[model samples]
Target chain A: MARWEPNARERLVRAAIDLFAEQGYDATTVTGIAERAGLTKTTFFRHFPDKREVLFAGQELHSRTLAEAVAAAPAQATPLEAVAAALDALAATFTEDRRDFAARLLAVIAANDELRERAAFKHDQLAAAIAGALRERGTPGPAAGLAAELGVRAFDDAFARWSDPSVARTLTDLAREALDELRAALAALG
Target chain B: MARWEPNARERLVRAAIDLFAEQGYDATTVTGIAERAGLTKTTFFRHFPDKREVLFAGQELHSRTLAEAVAAAPAQATPLEAVAAALDALAATFTEDRRDFAARLLAVIAANDELRERAAFKHDQLAAAIAGALRERGTPGPAAGLAAELGVRAFDDAFARWSDPSVARTLTDLAREALDELRAALAALG
Candidate 1:
């Protein structure tokens, strides 16, 4: 049980994710998550602004890590390449055991209209962050923007492939393969 | 006023879009749309299930068209290609004249979380419709799903490009171009 000693925050996430998976997102409540976590509702609030916020911990972290990776990239690297590398770095945080939870979270988001909108917003934010980082590194207007969006799409392709139950490769390996596939696909257009 | 004749449906849509674009989605009332359309408020309820339904008149039609297109495609066609052609058929309806209303409607949806959720739900429905169509056309399981998702991503890319005031082409043209781009990128990966 040492590995399972969840803090209040982790407990809330686990409870929320589990209850959400078992029943449904709409049926899950802050009260339920808190009670499952052995904490009061106030504790849940302290850790997250709303029930929705608790469900998005991994997403927020991914965004931060992705942004940092893009920002730290070398000068003169193309925006798409930089963003692709950043995405790979983010994927390294995932492990084989985490794939099930991640996949469930993704499916849950995909299954719900409200969560899908949040996911889209986060995708936009991730692209914007990458574009901003690119501009700072000297990439220009729509080029940076388009590259960022494309990078995001490639990362998405990588994520979907990686999260599949039958796919046994590491997330980074899948990301590289996805990036290569993306490059080939885009180049074919030209 | 021939162009603005009392097509009650059109009038309602125009009024609703106007109110939504101007006052923000949540704050605007169905009564406001009715009043603006010069009809009784009760008539608004007659035309729309709720205020929210006013913004999305032809989403179902669009999905059906896409499904039919996908179903009718050649069995040998690649999954992504088939879905792109289907979506292209759907894109044909958005002429340059509709750009303003479309952009405004998008902006309104973007500003409101609830409206955004509804939009995502609608998009997912379209994706499912396309996936089912692919299955009917003899495309395999997860490949069909991935193709449907890729098609959605292509449509999204084309949408962002066409919706930009700086973009100089129709959605179909942009979509075709993006599809080519996708093909090239994927080929490069291979």
Candidate 2:
């Protein structure tokens, strides 16, 4: 059934985000989202457990992407270097076509406390994934955790910029620059 | 009326933790918790908004403690130093008497998904409060955020250790040691 529906998952995500932005997240119902998507409530449930999850659909995939990238980094690579590789890999997934949607999604999340909390949970989960991967490569516990944090922070900072209309640089470039800036900021902490 | 029910808040918290631990978080109810506390449901409502909030009663106070300590640091203090001071101040509130309750609270949270998510949200909120204070003290954005994260992480790590019966060190000592270890780990990231 899903195969016959074409891009059912993508369509549901777009429709949900559109409705959330239009009517506000709190007021938008899953049934209305399904109706707007030209799909059924059953289909919506099939793709997402609930409306809140539609906005964070990429969490599991993004976590896997990061972990795999870290695991694939050269054995001799430093913790931060491995983290940098993971960030580049993850950033490549956010193509120009998704920029507007990403921007709107950020706004919708910012306006809702539940969504913001879910976003923070997703952020920590991604960091955990990256940290776990680094640890598997024999990076020490605290270093792995700190490096993973930097990677996620870099991506998050870059993502905000990438979502903006005026930011012309690629997500990859922005993430790299953000990571470099954070590394330098370490000195300023002292 | 409130003045007559001395330590009602503390009694409610203790009862809630004991109930949550014995019956499991999901199996517990506000009415049951209130009954265990020798308080009315109305009194329970006066203390907490919901059953889940009972386990996280200190969130607001903890955030204010971290922020105030950061704000009160000397003008010459560095970002990390300010964050360290905040951690020490926050850790001081968790006296030896609360160790058993703290340990039980952690176990209950770890066993429940909703509780874990709320814990993570509280962690980020604490970091944000500390970061805001650091920025007020003229710290740079990235550095402030990073320092605050380290402070929170240190406190979290130290808290787990402090909760252990075998760990004789004070929360302040454990938190300070954890922060120093993280600072050292920063060098290992590269």
Candidate 3:
């Protein structure tokens, strides 16, 4: 159990994922998760409002990381560059240690429509936060929003590549590649 | 009611929007919409599966308009131009006659979380259709996806502007302005 000795929140999350993967999300109850983690239902409730919340607990942190990175970009950086830099910063957070966990979480989300909706909502929230950060840097409407969305799309593409088991590239590398492709694609559009 | 002497689907849609605006989406029922349209609940069911489907009835038509337009673009047209052409085709369908109805529909969607989710889902569906059409034209992944998304964003911004009561511009004109702004913003990324 030494490998499993973590905080209650982490323990509960691990147990929930395992149960969800084993018995399906709908069939896995909070009590089942708690019992598997050798904890109480009350502890599970303390950590997450519900089973679905566990899958999205990092949303706020993820949004802050991207927005703060965009906000902190050099004053001379163009809006697109600032957004690209923000994507790089966020990508760096998805280290080798997270690949397996991300795969599991993504698979769980893929298997559930309710979870997919929540994921889409979280993606929108993150994009809006990035757009707000761009606006703070004096980028105007539609422009800021469009640039932020492009950046998010790059991050999303990179995350998918990095989460693949056979892929050895870092998230930052994949994201930069995806951003370049996006730029080239836009350039080709003209 | 001669002004509303249209098909049952349109009547049901009009009834649903009016009821949603007056009593909120949660309080509006299929029976309420049918009664408001002076039609039977059976007619409403034949046109839409439920109350929620009324708000999203146009998604398939919107997606087809975009994809078909993209597919028919001149071979020499840039990916962006192809997408721009698609937007113009779609904008032409949203005549001045739709401005008031569109505004009321948007307001009802804005006032309801479920409706907003459905809208986002519809927007994504439309973007994917555009990307597929771009791919059929030999544009690659990530690039096709990004360009398609940018075009959709332009349409979205333009739609908002077009729907405003005080705005006098045509949807095509607003979309052109928004698309130009997007191009300039993308170019500034370098």
Candidate 4:
């Protein structure tokens, strides 16, 4: 249904970002975004609740993609391995297409307290979602919770590394290294 | 300089929490908290910049205490264990006198987004402090960062479990358990 909406929800998001970037978030109005996308306020309202929703446009997709990635991991993969794969899947899903927007959105969210809190909440939700998926795969108790959270935390660290142009490693490489670091630190306890 | 404030910060915090629980946070004012503590408004303002200061009152001290705990860890201990010991130290500090008020503060911070964000930021600061302490103890590079963060994260997870009334485990036990879970997950991939 959304596919044939011409300038659909995603298109509105792209137009919104462009407008927001060009004129700053607060200065850019929904009407201007819709107009730029050749979309209407009704269509925009049909797609999103408000302007801030544009910043979170990729979150649901990111969460779903991560869930699917965890679900698809090899049966023999360790919990962290499964998590790493899930993060990799998310990186793949974003591709080059969403990289700019993802980074921008992250920066905007980082700078805004309310948005940062929302990001933290959503990250917890994703961690819970992954933990549940791991439970279905025979993972247990706090181990599952730790694995899920470690994955998200590692993702955060690795993504921070990967997103920086000065960062020398690929996203998957960074993910692998990040998990390796998690391993080494955990092992140091023994 | 802050020491000559009369009733002291701790007294003020206790009084504030009591009044907040009795009359609610929004309904309670600094004057009321100070008056309840039998201190003047000047004394209250001397100890705290404002009313919200009491709620987040322990952040600096908490970080310092944890840092000291990590630094005091024995050389034979693994990074994770040492970090765990630091957390144990902090727990012991809590159990000594003010655990109930601490628990109430945690609950209050957990319920409010602004407070939670501040809490999260403080955690980040604590983790960074731990990382610096690790480096001082001769841990290096990303290893130090990872170890410090792992310790902090593990401590956080363990504390959450330990503080739960339904969870019967001690913080050390939970920390060990979390490390075991982390070790198993990481070893599977290693």
Q: Judged by lDDT, which candidate is best?
A: 2
DockQ of 3: 0.44
Instruction: Please provide, for model 2 over B93-168, each residue's C-alpha lDDT reduced to its tens digit, 9 standing for 90 to 100.
Output: 9879999988999999999867777888889999999999999999889989999999999999999999899999
- Per-model DockQ against the true two-chain complex: 0.17, 0.67, 0.44, 0.24
The lowest-lDDT stretch of 10 consecutive residues in candidate 3 chain B is B1-10
Native-to-model Cα distance after best TM-score fit, residue B167 in candidate 1, in Å = 10
| Stretches of candidate 2 exceeding 4 Å from the true structure | none
True contacts kept of each: 0.13, 0.67, 0.47, 0.27
Q: Candidate 3: give the clashing pairs.
A: none
> What are the models' TM-scores?
0.70, 0.96, 0.88, 0.73
Compare candidates 2 and 3 on TM-score and give the better one. 2
| Model 4, position A182: C-alpha lDDT score | 68
The residue pairs that clash in candidate 4, if any, are none
Better of 1 and 2 by lDDT: 2
Model 4 Cα lDDT, one tens digit per residue, A27-94: 88989988998878888999888887876776678778877888899999877878888988876654
TM-score of chain B of each: 0.88, 0.98, 0.95, 0.79
The candidate that wins on TM-score is 2
State which docking tier applies to candidate 3: acceptable
Tens digits of per-residue lDDT for model 1 on B1-190?
Answer: 3343468887889889899878888788888888999987777777688888887777798789989889777788777778878978989977888777777777887887767667766766777888898878776654565467557657767887777788888899888777666555444332
